[model samples]
Target chain A: MSDTKRFLYVNRKAPHGTVYALESLEVVLIGAAFEQDVSLAFLDDGVFQLVKKQVTTGIGVKNFAPTYRALGDYDVKKLYVERESLAERGLTEDDLMEVTHENDDEEDVSSIEIVDRARMAQIMAAQDVVLSF
Target chain B: MKFAVVVNEGPYTHQASDTAYQFTKAALEKGHEIYRVFFYHDGVNNATRLTVPPQDERNVQKNWSELAEKNALDMVVCIAAAQRRGILDEGEAKRHGKGEGSANIAPGFRISGLGQLIEAGIQADRLVVFGD
Candidate 1:
């Protein structure tokens, strides 16, 4: 077996409309299965993947947000959200499932750290592998 | 380390391509080698040679082509996606009986199958994706 790899998974698309979100999740699971240290970052519309109270049966699609909670079981506990993305969508930590936040804004969801884009870029640069979906 | 980059979105459609490009550049700068870049789904549009965006807008096609040329990147476009989206290489155009002069395959890019992606993944240390 190969040694474990460190991976940063960045999701930048909406959850329901596009396959990117689902596919990214699949990749994350695969990476975890390979014993890789995996982290997930949701930027732009990708934050919708963590949105609580989603109802997808109307669209004939099973809501996959619940699957996100299982990521911890796979040892993928590093879930991050961009503060700006939440603000852009008029969302807050209350709107999403419990996780960690990377920023410091009360009005905004404190669930995840709100790291600035520059810091985010730096984090991405430090990663051994990055997959954007 | 070697890498297989799968780009599934077009250049101007979103930041997926730009992000992929920047990451690839960073990877190279970090003493890493890109085994291949496989463009699929909407990403096959990145290989269209006939794109001519406005001067004010960023020409993503040119950027990709330039990077590919400088690094001698192995760029592969999914043939099925290319044909379905009206992007055809010389051989494909000829086989399909299109105009004789249609050159949809951009330089530094080859239309190929998923096998190329699988091969790249097996050879590289990592398989990264910039998906739509």
Candidate 2:
């Protein structure tokens, strides 16, 4: 990557019903190839996207819930979830699917970082580019 | 300043595309550069040449094509999103075994991967998103 910029993707919608969630993820995956500094923040209903064991066969849509786990391989290891959003949806860290990536030290590290709304604001303010979905 | 625009909605049903077009046009008028306009989600629909809107109504696709023609803008429609929304280019049409004229991409818009989007973000001074 030439002159890597801090890129952040803000996902604030539900996984299904609309296509924003999938579209946002598609960008993240494609951006991963360039090895840029990327981070994903899941707030509002986007936090629901990480709920474990999502079965969408009945809705005639592919179950893409498992794809979140593969983000680590793409070097998209910063998965930030708003702590208040999770609590608002009656979810805990246990409800989220575990996603981990190997660090520069070669140690397995969890990618998901549950942060408060204040910190989420700070994170947004710190990015070179903020792509909202 | 170099700008990157992201359109996340389709044509007429939403104002996202229209607003993005106006903003992009103004930006060019103000002597700023548009690095790229990456269409995602339903926004891929804006690249279709098959639309036949009401006579009195503004044609969204035409507006974009004309603007691009005049300004030499890089309007990229996401391949994945276009495929999901039934928008196809010449290559996609042939690969999918569709009949002639199946490719509905307009003159100024090209089908490309999301890598173009990332590149735009990396290259542009500002990345503006228009969506719901």
Candidate 3:
């Protein structure tokens, strides 16, 4: 077992409309500030946060997608994208930003992980701290 | 172990608060120490002092207060969420020109920022969240 503390932040909501996703991200960043081993998992509508070409300025909402990239600078390098979610939404790895790590060997993306939903569940079960958004 | 729990959903309307309550209980039973309980987003409503649920139903707000007091838990309400939701402290209520009664948040809580959550993680062994 890893001696480091593992934190799982599961964001299940979309960006922009509600504060759930953003606040969750903030919590993860804070966790990193404390030197904890933090990981983020985007599930359901939460995957929208990783989508590319978001235009919130037109709606007068602050574009939160840019903040997603800041996670890397904060040392939150583990970002997981659920595979079934992508398949159901007809989205490919190319639709998201470069910061995401795709786990799917089939997808040609270089940075995101596309794990199966069951595998995602396993990851959650393994974490010492799991926060759901 | 030292711990911090962030609650992002309102207590009355959702299951998030209930789940957090249960988790805290379990963690405490296992002899873990809780550092703080931060409420944000719609969760600011969890600190309302005027909540009055039906007599037949559980009074979640009062229950939360009791839990904190009994555990000697440190509770914080996010300043941003509290302002947007009209939940305020004495200083903020005066700044907003609202009456003292309108501004005082529920007792047993403090107003704080995201940085505090980070500090909680640094100071505690774990940081857990039950979000909306």
Which consecutive 10 residues in model 2 chain A have the weakest lDDT in total? A17-26
What TM-score, to 2 decimals, does candidate 1 have? 0.56
DockQ scores for all the models shown? 0.13, 0.92, 0.45
lDDT of each: 0.77, 0.93, 0.78
Off by over 4 Å in 1: A99-112, B1-3, B10-132
Q: What local lDDT does model 3 show for residue A26?
A: 65
Between 1 and 2, whose lDDT is larger?
2
Better of 2 and 3 by TM-score: 2
Better of 1 and 3 by TM-score: 3
TM-score of chain B of each: 0.94, 0.98, 0.91
Interface RMSD of the candidates, in order: 5.0, 0.7, 3.6
What ordering of candidates by DockQ runs from best to worst?
A: 2, 3, 1
lDDT per residue (tens digit) for residues A1-133 in model 3: 3445677778888898887776677667656757777888998988888999889877897777787876666767788899888878888787988773333464423445778999999998887777677
lDDT of 2 at A73: 88
For model 1, what is the error of residue A14's alpha carbon versus the real structure, in angstroms, after optimal superposition?
1.2
* TM-scores for every candidate against the unseen true structure: 0.56, 0.96, 0.78
> Which digits, one per residue and each the tens of the lDDT, describe model 2 over residues B1-132?
999999999999999999999999999999999999999999999999999999999999999999999999999999999998899988999999987878999999999989899889988999999998
lDDT of 3 by residue, B10-101 (tens): 97779988888888878877988988988888988988888878899987677778888888888889887788788888889888888656
Correct interface contacts retained, every candidate: 0.19, 1.00, 0.62
Off by over 4 Å in 3: A1-4, A100-111, B1-4, B22-34, B54-57, B94-101, B118-132
CAPRI accuracy category, model 1: incorrect
Candidate topping lDDT: 2
